[model samples]
Target: MERRRSSSCKMSLCKSASSSLGYVDSSMDVDCGSGWKYAPQVVLVKIYSFLNDTDRAIMARVCRNWSLAFEAGCLWRRRRFEMGGYRARTAEFQASGFAEKFGQHLRYLTISCNHPSLVTCKIFQRAMEAFLPKLQRRAKLKEFRFSRLEMDRYWRYEQLKEKLILTLTRFLRQQFCLRVLDLSYSQFYLSAGLRIIESVGLSCGHCLRRLIMEDIFHSRLTVYSGLRYKRAISRFTNLRTISLNYGYLSDDVMEILRGNLAGKLKTMRVRVYRSDPHGHRITKLAWNGLRRACPSLKVKFNFESIGFASDIIPILVAGIPLYELYIWTGFDDNSDWRLSSILNHVAVNFKDTLEICNFEFDNSTEMIDDALFRLTQSCVRLRSFITNAVLLISTIQNICELVEQRKLDPRTFHITACNLSDLEWAELAYLQEKYANMADERSIDFRLSSDLIVESRHAEF
Candidate 1:
């Protein structure tokens, strides 16, 4: 009898799992309150939310109610259209017609320029052109993102770039109130970048909140216009968050941001790239003034270097609160970086408020164990620690411990490129399963698998 009951219980759990996976469908329509076919609109919409975009698209074909729920305006507000290997190949996506259909519904829109086909396709271009008019009229659009656009050796590169900039400018000028705009890694010319920001500022001014315009591409001929930058940035009077490349930021720009009141400015992200020889021109005094004005403001600093961190780390770490830091360096052919320089200061100094820490190192470099320990142990608010460098087994364990202790708040420790042996992976899997059982028994909500994203096959198990 006990064995039969156990089998019944297992069957029920499997059914529950299947339900959550969201494949249940039947076409026998009934009255609004009769049965599953006639579930309330809210309930149906909520169920639709659980299914991913692909599944939702497939499910939409199941029934009229399901189709309506899938097309409900609420779900379409925040949209990200990118062509990855999966998305590009998916015939059912109808990505070509997305802009024409859902232009008015989009409050937050993110489109990737990294995909060659999506950006270059004539159908997509026409759709975008049609879409921009809808946004212009609606004026409800709040976020616009075009990320990972880089130059190449295509014959019509210059011609296409000019056309793209014109189209982008037209789109930007239409939106009157945008909260977030990301143009990072786009490698846009200074003039073109200025024009885009100027368009937003001319329209969006007071309503604009976060602007990410760093790592802008520069060439020998394209001039760097501080005046143009000042003109464009000063128009946005209520910016709460901003990310700008340090190479172009003059003292005037910093002063403009300070602007006597520091209106709504809470977060500042600065990227220091190695291409520019001048380094950062903002003085220690300007940093101090900004810190004094906005004591609660925290900085997310990304420093990219071929060798050690640029000399500006001292000036930066001195005044503002270092909330997050990412160091991407070639690590020089010289084997080791002494902790005293940047790592020790980061691990020891900003332990209280430092939440996100990431390091992208070249192949030859390995993170020192001591630094990882200090980072793991000290950072009480540390939410993320991601790296490409291969970490030691003990180091990985320390990160796991961090997550286990901070079970209430979700933390992420990701090793993106660590080539772990099968044996090592198996050991980690064992520990993972052990923790899973313990977490379940104790009713601890956070599990290590979701938070600790390592390359392991037994992750689901």
Candidate 2:
């Protein structure tokens, strides 16, 4: 009995010793630092660094490995919320607490919607409330462009009027570091006319630098009232550049703009619509306004009506110091306006700053040819002569000759006729041959329709 007891005691002692040894080894392994595992925080950062905002947000929800990826603030840098509808598989919605996840990194935000309804506005407001606070807190957003898309062009005229007030209030009131605000293509009608003018004119006081009003063709009430100018022009102390379509400011409206914006105007672009009998007055006003408002303003007036250019050219030459000139047939049946004398006058007055001299006409190729011949003979510093379909083959040849001889200061001549096909190839070939014969120093870009096929054949002189 005594021997058996001693043997059992020895076995017990050995088991205890082995257990102690294992514990000590385990402690040593942990302290050695080589056995440290990667935590969720580190892994999330690595994932964010590799992917874009939308992708990163998606992957973060996949599993435990990705949850932390979204929590890291840098993943939400640029937030683009295109209103209306985006396909589900392509665009991600903020339904899954996305705003709370990465709102801090939004530096640039663009909000686009097509004639948003009341319900749509509410939903947008909710989303904005969710994300914008975080963005404002985290990033100093520098640029914001809100585009209100009009599908039918005329369908949303009434809807825009009702909603524009609320929309502008929300946008301007929101504390953002916005430098450039572009509100284009929002159809203006009588219902929303004065409100829009008031909202933009009043809200953009100290914040705006550049303003562009395009294609504002709406109700006659707003167009005739022209009351919007009261607020619109008053807030332009810091404005350096302005571009307006023909519909917004016709020739007849120049009488109203004299004391309003004349002193501050710097660079102006007037797109004249010729159909209105008031067009002549508008053209005259533009010339007179530029001369009076800005002593040395650079004007780039696009003549949309050929009939009016005859009257407008003289006014422009006498009134303002035009830096560039681009003339084209307005959106109607082609009407040829003799441009020789006008071209000569431009070349004579603004000799130093003449950059782009372009003419776009539709038909009567012979008339355009005569215009080109006269321009080539008289104007010495012509840069770019862009002729639409109305230009003839002979005109192209003459312009090419001047370009090849180095007599014309321009580097390119874009000759476009009706359509691009083999139909106009004969004329193109003839012009190419003439250009080659002249040993042209400057290469010309030739377009039979719209496709550019060859450089000037006379590019060696």
Candidate 3:
């Protein structure tokens, strides 16, 4: 009787297990619509990976949970505007809806239009009206950028179109949260645009941080005004990085920024386009502004026609915290030893914190070789170097030597040279072999491609 009872108990347990399996199988088709099948965090991550502006908008319709994902504050943190040729309404309609839904979440925004014309400005204004209210409600907008390159107009405008232009300009000036702004218009003169900027600078004093104005035609227009800059300095007490593209910045304007910054700035990059010797002098004056603004500084310089290298070394060495340097030397008509002298001077001083250096050359081979030798000796801890010029065999050897001496196990070096001699080819072959041997020990990459061909691949190092 006891044995029979044990058998019955085993049969009952088997039946219960079978019933559980059957229920699970039957419920396989059950919809997860109302259930917490996936966590909210997981859903949020999936929404973040949507490709384009349209994809981001479509995500709002996915599931009730996903619909709310677009409204999440994190999604609108950094807005990017790809302004293509006169800010089309189609683009604005799409972007503004997305921005209106999430603008309050924005912390950084980038705007790039195909053409930065009056029409583009109008479209931007329309989008802003749709989105800025929501952004203001959230009080989260922080940084904004306006980038454009003047190209041939696709649609011409009538000369009497002044009202539309004024309206668009007013919208930009009043859009409150544009704290840090970058204008790639490159044509900002000391005219109407400057006046608008100055007006905003004084009124919107609470938030602005950095203003970078680019590509002014200095020879044709003298637009840098001392009064405007001083006003800007007084208004935006938080202002840090202020850079001008052309060499038109007056000394007084430079001094205002320098005095206000007073040693808290990190990076100051200035590009001087004029070939005047005075232009190079202006570059130094800009650096001095940064130095005066901060007791110690980090600065980057790009000058197209630098006449005197000797004058720059003192200014550069003074910024002891200066690390990364990019110099574009077009031609060395006066001195062959200039590049060498500059590198040696830097190598002797800024050897500790410097990580990357990029140099572009339109100079003699001898001068290039001297520069390479000095670079290896100085920038020992450097991790990346980029150059488009044809580096000589000795220069290549110097780079390889630097790699060895610094014990920089893994380094990225980019060199673009189309035509190469037999010896150069041999050097490449040797470098390839060395790279192969160190494939697992370190990472080294090489690329040779045709202009029209596009291919993607991944290799395990």
The best-first sequence of candidates by TM-score reads: 3, 1, 2
Q: Could you say which candidate leads in TM-score?
A: 3
Q: Pick the candidate with the highest lDDT.
A: 1
Would you list the clashing residue pairs of candidate 1?
none
TM-score of 1: 0.67
What lDDT score goes with residue 66 in model 1?
Answer: 61
Write one digit per residue (lDDT tens) for candidate 3, span 422-456: 44555555665564545435565433211122224
Per-candidate Cα lDDT values, in order, are: 0.62, 0.51, 0.53
In candidate 3, position 28 carries an lDDT of 42
RMSD of 1: 11.0
**In model 1, what lDDT does residue 172 have?**
84
* Models, CA RMSD each: 11.0, 14.5, 13.3
TM-score per prediction, in order, is: 0.67, 0.63, 0.69
Least well predicted 10-residue stretch by lDDT in candidate 1? 6-15
